[model samples]
Target chain A: MARPMGSVRLKKTNPATLAVGVALCIFIIYFLIGPSTSDFSASRKATAAAHHLSPPTSPFRKPTGDKQKPPPVAHYNLNNVTTTPNPLENRENILLLTPMARFYQEYWDNILRLEYPHELITLGFILPRTKEGNDATRELQKRIALTQNQGPEKDRFKSIIILREDIDPPLTSQDEKERHKMENQKARRAAMAKARNSLLYSTLGPATSWILWLDADVVETPPTIIQDLASHDQAITVPNCFQRYWNEEKNEMDERPYDFNNWQDSPTALDLAKKMDPDDILLEGYAEMATFRTLMAYMSRENGRLHEEMPLDGVGGAALLVKADVHRDGAMFPPFAFYNLIETEGFAKMSKRLGWQPVGLPNYKVYHYNE
Target chain B: MARPMGSVRLKKTNPATLAVGVALCIFIIYFLIGPSTSDFSASRKATAAAHHLSPPTSPFRKPTGDKQKPPPVAHYNLNNVTTTPNPLENRENILLLTPMARFYQEYWDNILRLEYPHELITLGFILPRTKEGNDATRELQKRIALTQNQGPEKDRFKSIIILREDIDPPLTSQDEKERHKMENQKARRAAMAKARNSLLYSTLGPATSWILWLDADVVETPPTIIQDLASHDQAITVPNCFQRYWNEEKNEMDERPYDFNNWQDSPTALDLAKKMDPDDILLEGYAEMATFRTLMAYMSRENGRLHEEMPLDGVGGAALLVKADVHRDGAMFPPFAFYNLIETEGFAKMSKRLGWQPVGLPNYKVYHYNE
Candidate 1:
C-alpha cells in the first residue's frame, strides 16, 4: 500500500513536469530558428541601405558604437553561380560608382540611355561639400526621385545613393587648364583617389557582382556599354575615353584622345618609375613628366574594331569596369603613391600586384565631355 | 496488480525525464551567457586592433562579409564622469593624431618632450605611400618599437598606430616654395585633409577623451603643451603657430607667423566668401587669394600671456587640441569646399556649424619647423 501511494504521488507531478518540458522545448526551438530567419532579412535590408541608399538624415554621419569591430573580410562563393555567355541572362548585379565634383546634365542623360537592365544597376555618387556639389546633389536627388518614384518601372534604377564627401577637395577649380597642370596632377589624383575609395568602400555590397567606375563628365558611350564591358568577363576593362569638339576649320565634330591614363608601360616608363622619387608620381600626357607609353585613345581606328582588346599596365578612371572580387581581393586607387603612381594608375598597379589583369578596348570608345 | 505495475513504470521514467530537463537547461544557459561575455572580450580586442594596431597582414584589406553592417553610433555616458579643474588629475586619455608626408626627427623628439602622462597618451600617425613617407614610416616604426618595447614602463605610451595612406597624395614635393604655391594650396590642403581624416577615423576609439592634431613639422612646444591645451577643456583650441628663421639682416633668429589659417574672419573675408564662386576656395597667406583676416600667429607677445584665449573663425592643423566629443559630434576637415574653405579652416567652419565654439590662444605659442 505504501509503494502504491508513493507511485500515485509521483504520477500526479509527472504530467505537470512533462507539460513544462514540452512548452520549453517549443519556446527554445522557436527562438533558435526564428531570429536567424529574421536576421537574414534584416541583414539584406541593411546591405541595401549601406550600398544603395542613405537614410533621409545625413549621408556623412559616422557609423556609431564604441565596440564596433571592423567588418569581416568579404568572400563571394561564385562556385555555385553558373556563368552564362550572355551577361544579360546571367543577371549579375552591377554597381555604378561615380565621384562627382561638378554636375553635368549630359552625363546624367547618358546614364539614362544605357541599355543595361536598370533594375539590375545600383547607382552611387560621392559629391564634394561645396556650393557646386550642393547644387548637383539637389538636382540629382530631384531627378532620382522623379524617375524612381514616378517613371516606369523599367526605367528606374534598382537603387541610388548620394554621399556628401567628408573631406574637402583641395582644388575646386574646374578650369581644364588648371586641372591638367602637371604640377596639380598629384594633388588632384590623390583627392580623386580618396573620393573613389570613400564611394567604393561605402557602397560596395554583397549583391554587387561588378563595379563600373563612370566619371561624371563621361557624356557619350554606346547604349550597350554595360553589356559590351560585362561580356569581356575580365578582371578589369576600360574603354578608350575620347572627346568630340566642333572644329572651327572643318565645321564638323572632330574627335581627340582625352584620357591618356590607359596605357601599356614602355621600358622607358618603367625605368622612369624605378628612378623616380618614391613620392614623385609619374603622370601620363605631360611633356615635363614624360613616360613614352602607348595611349589606348590613339589606338582607335576610324572604322569600328570595338572588340579589339589589349593587355594594359595602367588604366584610367573614365568608363572603367571591374569585377567585385578584384576589389574584394584588395585593389583600390592608392591615394598615396604606389610604384610611383596614384589614383587609377595606382589601382592598376595594385590590381596587377593581386594577380588580376587590367585590359583595355582600344577601339571601344567612350566620349568625355568637351571641357 | 495492473495499477501497481503502471505506477512502477512511471517511477522509472521520472528520473530519465528529469535528468534530460536539467541537462537542457544547463546547455541553454551556457550558450546564452557564454557567447555574450566572449563577444565582449573579442569586440574589445577588435577595437584595440582597429584603433591601435594593424595585423601583420595587409592593413588595406577590406573588412569582409556580405552581412556587414555599419557600427552603431557611439554614445559616451560622460554624465557619470566627474569634471576636475586640473586635467592632469582627470585621468583623461588623449589621442595624439599626426598626418605626415615627411618625417622630421625633431618632431618625434618634441613629442617625447611632452609632459602629458605617457600611459594616457595613444599616438597615431598616417603617412603617405611615397618614398619620403616610406622612409618616415620605417623610422617612425623603429623609434616607436624601441620606445614601446624596450623603454622604461613610465616612458612607454599607452599604445601606438602607424598607417600608410590608402590614396596617393596629389603632390609629393617637399619643396617649401612648391608646397606653399597658391595654385597648389587647394590640392595640397585637400590631400592633407584626406590623410588627417583617414588617420582620425581609423584610430579613434571609445577610450579617447581628447584629440591633438600635431603636424609633423611642428617641432617645438612647451613641455606641458598637452596639459596646457587640455586644461582649457574647450570644444576646440589652437595655439599660435610661428617659425624662427636665421635673420641674415638682423644677425639673429627672427620670428614670423607660420600658420595663417588660424584667424578671426574679418568682414572683408566674410564678404569675399559670400561673393566668391561656390567652388572657389579662400586661401590664407597668399596675396592673390587674400582675405584680410586677423591672424592668431601675429597676435602672440614676447612675454608670458600663454593662456590668453580669443574667439576664432578658423584654426590651423599645426597644433590644435579638441575634445573627443567635438570630433565624435561630426566636426571633420572637409576635403571639399565648405563656405569657400577646405582642410583645417574648413574644420573650424564645420565645428561652428555643429554648435561648437573654436577658440585660439594668441599668446600660446607652438613653433613650426622653418621650411
Candidate 2:
C-alpha cells in the first residue's frame, strides 16, 4: 500500500473493514450452497399453490336458467372412493380381475396352474361389461350386478367386490404420425376407473384391501412371481416385456428373454388432438406407471421421477396389483368423459397421486399371445 | 411250368444259390437279434491309403539309392507287433503335449495353468522359429530346439513326450485354390516335423508306451479326455473331425455342429493321402482325430481289428496320446514335400496301413477358441 502496489496491496485493516469483509465471505458461502443443500421449497407446497395456481373459471356456467336437468353422473371427483381400513387385518388379501373375454378358459386352464409361496397371492375376479351400447344395455348391466353379487372365494382376499358396468368401446386412433404411442396410458386409466367404481360400490367393498388385474392373453402365469412380490412391501412390477434386438433375435426359443424396447408408446391428449387416427398414430408417446414408489418420487423433488418412465409408455394391464386404501385416499381412477383411452393412463395418474413407486423384476414374465 | 398261375413255377434253386439264400436268411436273423447298435465309434479309423502302396519313383528315393539316409517311413500292420500282452502294463504309458501361446495368457498368468487330474495333461511349450534379424529377432531354430528340450513338466504317468516336430511341413502345392484355406498350416507343419525329428533323435529317443499331442486352445479339457484315451490300449481320438461346411458368415456365431452335409462333398482318399498333400507333404485337412485306438481300427482283418472307416476329417490334438511302440515299429508321420494340410488325414493314412479305423466322438469337445 505504501507504493500503491498495482492492486496487490497488503495493507493493515481497521475493525469496521475487517468485520465487513467477514460478513461478505459468509454471504458468498450461503449463496453458493443454498439451493442444492435442501428441499425446503418443495416441502412448502401449500404456499406455492396459493401463489402459483391460476384462478378457477365460473362454476356451473353461471346458473343458466336453461338447466332443467343435472349431470347424469351423481358422483363428484368421479373417483368417489370409501376410505376405511378393514377390521380384519393379516388376512393376506389378493385381488384378481377377470375381464369377461377369455375368462372361463383362462380360469380352467390357469388358476393354481403351479405352486407358489403360501399366503403370498390371493385371487379375485372382476366381471367385465358385456356391452357398451349408448346407455349401457340392461342385460350387460344385470351381469355386472350379478357377478358382483356372487362374492369372492372362501380363501380369497377380495372382501371388496368391484363391479364394472361402464366399459369403453374399442376405438383406434388413426393418426399416421402417432401409432400405439399412447395405448398403455389410455387403457390403464380406463381400466383403473372401472375397477375402482366397482370396488367402491360393493357389499364387502370397504373390507377389500388389494386388487390385481391380469391380461386376457396370459396362457401360463407363474405363481412364484406373486410370491416374490409379496416378499417385499415395496411397490414393484414383475418384468413383463420383451424386445427383438439385432443380436437377440438369433436366440432360440429356450434363449429368449423379455424385451423392453418394443413397448407401445402412448401419446398425450395434445398430440392426439392434432390428428386422431390409428394409422397416423406415432409410437413415441408415454405414460407413468401406477406404483407407490413412483408416486412418492413424483411427490418429492428428487428421485428423478421424470426419468425414462418405465411401465408408463404402456402398462401391460396384463398384470397389476394395488392396495385398497391407496385408491380411497388417492381418489381412485376417474371415468373418462370424452375418450376411451383411460384404463392404462388413469391408473398411472391415480398411483402417482397416491405416492406409490413402480419396480420391475427380471425373473418374472407373463406368457401370452397377441394378435 | 406245371401251371401258369401268375407265371409262378416251382423251381429248385442251384446249390450255390441255395447256400447263398440260406446264408442270407441267417444273416437277416442275426442282424435282427444281434441288437445291432453303434458304440462310441472312437475305435474306427476313416478311409486311409489303400493297401499295396507304390513306393515313391524318384531316382533318389530311399531303398533304390542310399538306405542309410533314413529310409522312407514304414507302414504298421498287426503282423509287425508282438501279439502277446505285457502283464507289466501299469497305468497306460502316456505322452502329454501342452504348448504355451501368446493369447493363451489367461490360462496361466499364475499357477502354471493347472486344471486337471494332474497325472493327465503333460504341459508343453509352443514351437519357436529361426530368427534372421537383429537383437530383436529371436532365432527360430534355436527357439524350436529349446522349446522341445524344455518341454512339459516332468511327470511319471506321462513319461512319453510330444514335441512340435512331430508334424511334417511342405513347401508348395499343385493346387493353389485349395491350399489357401488352411490355418497357419505351412509353418505349423514345419515346426511339428522339426519337433518330432528332434525328439526321435534325442537322448529320450525311444517314445514311451504312448505319445500325446494336445491342442493349446482347448478349454475344459477334462482329465477324462486323457483318462478316456488311456483306457483304450489302442489309438483313439475323442473328438474325431469330419468335413464340415461352417459358413462363418451365417449368424456370426450360431455355428451348429459339423455333420454329413459338409462332408458329402469332400475328396475320397486313403486316410493317409487324405492327411497329406498330393505331393506327399504334411497337411491336416481331414475331419477327425486319431489315437492308438485309431491304430487298433486299422490293425487288420486277421488281427481281429474290424473297425469300418467312418471317414472322419481330423482328430483333436488337445490331449492326443499314442503308444510308443506304434512309432518305434517304423510308424511315423508321412513325408510332405510342401506344407502339411491335415493332421487327421496324416494320422488316417498311417492308421489304415496299421489296420486302424478312425472314429468320431459325438460329445467330446475339447476346449477350443470359438473366435
Candidate 3:
C-alpha cells in the first residue's frame, strides 16, 4: 500500500523542473528562427540579380530620322563628336573565348566583367558541345565565378566560353561496331562549330577598340581586365605563351630546351633563309637543329602566309589581341574551327598585308599552362 | 830585301810540296768520285719528275691488242661499276687536290714526299708565288696534300696559295688603277685552275668512279666516313661542307638552323656551297646554311642529265667528284682564279653546258673554320 502511493506521487509533475524545461525550449526556438528568415531573403535577391543580368543596348539620344549610331567603340579625337558617358571609359567590354585543350577544365570569372571605373559589354564563347568517351581531349571546359571572390578568379578567366563534347554524352554504338567510326568523326565536327563560326566575332561592339580573348584555363587578376587591355595605336603583340608539357625523351618535363638553354642546332624551316646573321643565336652543335623550333612555329599551316611550299595561315592564339577600332578593311581570322598552331597567323598575315608590323614585345608576356 | 826574296820564294818554290799536295788532292778526288756522280744524277732525276710526271699509257696492253690481258679494272663487277675508295684506309688512295685556303703558306718541305711509299700523284695546287708584304691575306694561308694513301692527316692538304704576280708570264689588270688588286685576285683564280684542270684527275683511270676536291679550313673525323661516302652510289653528291661565320651576339660561330626554328634566320655563305642538284640554291640561304658542306665524292661531272638549274654548268671546285673517263662536254672552270665562293657555280655552268654532273655528298660532314 505505501509503495503504490509513492509511485503515484513520483508520476505527478514537479513545479521547479517544468519551469526550467519551458525556458530551455523557448531559447532554442528563438535562436533557430531568427537567422534563417534573413539568410533566405538574401539568397533570393542574389538569384534574382543573376537572372536579370541582361546584355545592354544603346539608348536613343538622336531622332528616328538619324541612322542608328555605331555601337560604342574605342574611339579617339574628342572634337569630332560628342556624347555623354564615353563608352571607352564606362561601358562594358566583350571578349570571345575558347578552350585551352580539347575540353574545358578551369575556373573563369569576370574575365571581361566591367568593374572599377569601367563598364563591361559581354562575354563571347566558342564552345564545342556534345561528345562521348574516347572522343574527349585534354582541355579546359567550364566557366564559373570563383567561390572565394563571388566575381573572378585570381588569373583564370573564360572570356569566351569554350564548350567541348558534352560531358557523359550517350554512346550511340556500344556493340563494338566499326560502322560507328564514321559517326564518331561526325560528332567531332559538329562539336567544333561554335569556334569556327564568324558570327560570334562580328558581334564585338563597334565602340570596343581592344578585343582580347584568352583560353578557358587562363585566369585574370584584379577582377577587371579593362585597364590591361588598352594598347597603343599600332600592331599589338606578345611574347610566346608559356606552357609546361611532359617530354618523353628525357623521361621528365624539361624547360632546358624550350623554356631555357635557348633553342640550338634547329634549322630555319623557311625556304628563304639567309646565312646566320651576326646578331643570331650562339650555338655548339648543329646536329640537334633546335633553332627550327621557332621556324616550325612560323612555317606551320596556321601561323603564316600561303607560300608556294607552305600553307600556314596564322599564329598562336594562347594570348592574342587586335585593335577594336582598327581601320583595316579585313581583320578576321580564317573561318576554320580547328587549326594546328595557326592562331597567330591571322595577326601576322593581316599585319604583313597592311604594311603594319606585328612585333612580339618583351614586356608583353603570358604564362600559359600548356598541360 | 830578304823579306821580299822570302815572299817570292814562298810563292814560287813549292814544287816538291806541290807534288805532294797534288798527289793528296788526286787521292781525295778519286775517293769521292762515285758518290759525287751518284748525287748529281739523283738530283737531276728528282727535278725532272717534279716538273714533268705523266700517266703511263699502255698501247700494247689495249684489250683489242691482247687476247689475254688483265681485266680493265681489278675486282670489277656490275654491282660496283664505279667505286669510291674508303676515306680511312684509302685516305691517300683517293686524292682530292684543291687550293682552297691552305696552299699559300711556305713549308720547308712537303709531307707528301716524305710519308708515302708510292710517288704521290698530287694533282691540285694553288698557283702564283709569294713573298713578304704582298697581299695582306698572305698570313691566312696553309698547305694541304690530297694523296693516294688513306690516313688521318690526308685531309690536311687544303690551303690558300698566294700567287706571285711579278712573273715573266705576267698578270695584266683589266683596270690599270686596280692592277695590284686584280693581280691578287688572279692568284686565287689560278689556284682554282689547278683543281679543275689537273692531269692526275684525268688519269684516275676510266675504271675510277669519282674525285673529291676539298677546301682547306674544314674540320672532320670519323672512322666510318669512307664507308659512308661509299654508301651513296648516286652520280653526284657532296660531303658535308658547313660554313662558319663569327656571330657578334653570341661572340662565337654557330651552325645555321636546319629544323626551321627561325625560318632560315641565318644563312650559309654562298662560297660554302658547290651543289650539283638542279634546284637554284642561290635563291635560298646559301650564305650561312649548313646544307652546303663540302663532303662531296660522287659520280663524275659526266652525268649531264643530273643537273637542270644553272644546268650542271659544273660543280664548285671546292668539293667535287667526277666519273672516271666520262668524257667532258662541259666548259672547265672560269679563267679567273677565284670569285669568292663561285668556283662551284662556275664549274656547274660548264658541266651543264657540256652535259656532265658535278656531284656533292652531304653525308661527309666537313666543317669549315670560322675566319
lDDT of 2 by residue, A6-62 (tens): 111111100111100000000000000001101211121211110000000001111
What DockQ class does candidate 2 belong to?
incorrect
The weakest ten consecutive residues by lDDT in model 2 chain B span B22-31
The local distance difference test score of each candidate is: 0.60, 0.29, 0.27
Better of 1 and 3 by TM-score: 1
- Contacts from the true interface found in each model, as a fraction, amount to 0.00, 0.00, 0.00
Candidate 3 per-residue lDDT over residues A195-313, each given as its tens digit: 32222222232223345555444433233333443433334433333334467897897421111111111244221123433222222113332223332222223343322121222
lDDT of 2 by residue, B94-129 (tens): 334443222233223211333322332222333322
Off by over 4 Å in 1: A1-85, A168-176, B1-371
- Poorest 10 consecutive residues of model 1 chain B by lDDT? B24-33
Give chain A TM for each model in order: 0.78, 0.43, 0.43
Q: To one decimal place, how large is model 3's interface RMSD in Å?
A: 51.0
Give the poorly placed runs of model 2, Cα more than 4 Å off. Answer: A1-371, B1-89, B98-103, B106-123, B130-191, B196-207, B240-319, B337-344
Query: How would the candidate models be sorted by lDDT, starting from the highest?
Result: 1, 2, 3
What's model 2's TM-score?
0.26
lDDT of 1 by residue, B6-58 (tens): 22222221110010000000000000000011222113121221111111111
For lDDT, candidate 1 versus 3, the one ahead is: 1
Model 1 Cα shift for residue A3 (angstroms): 99
DockQ of 1: 0.02
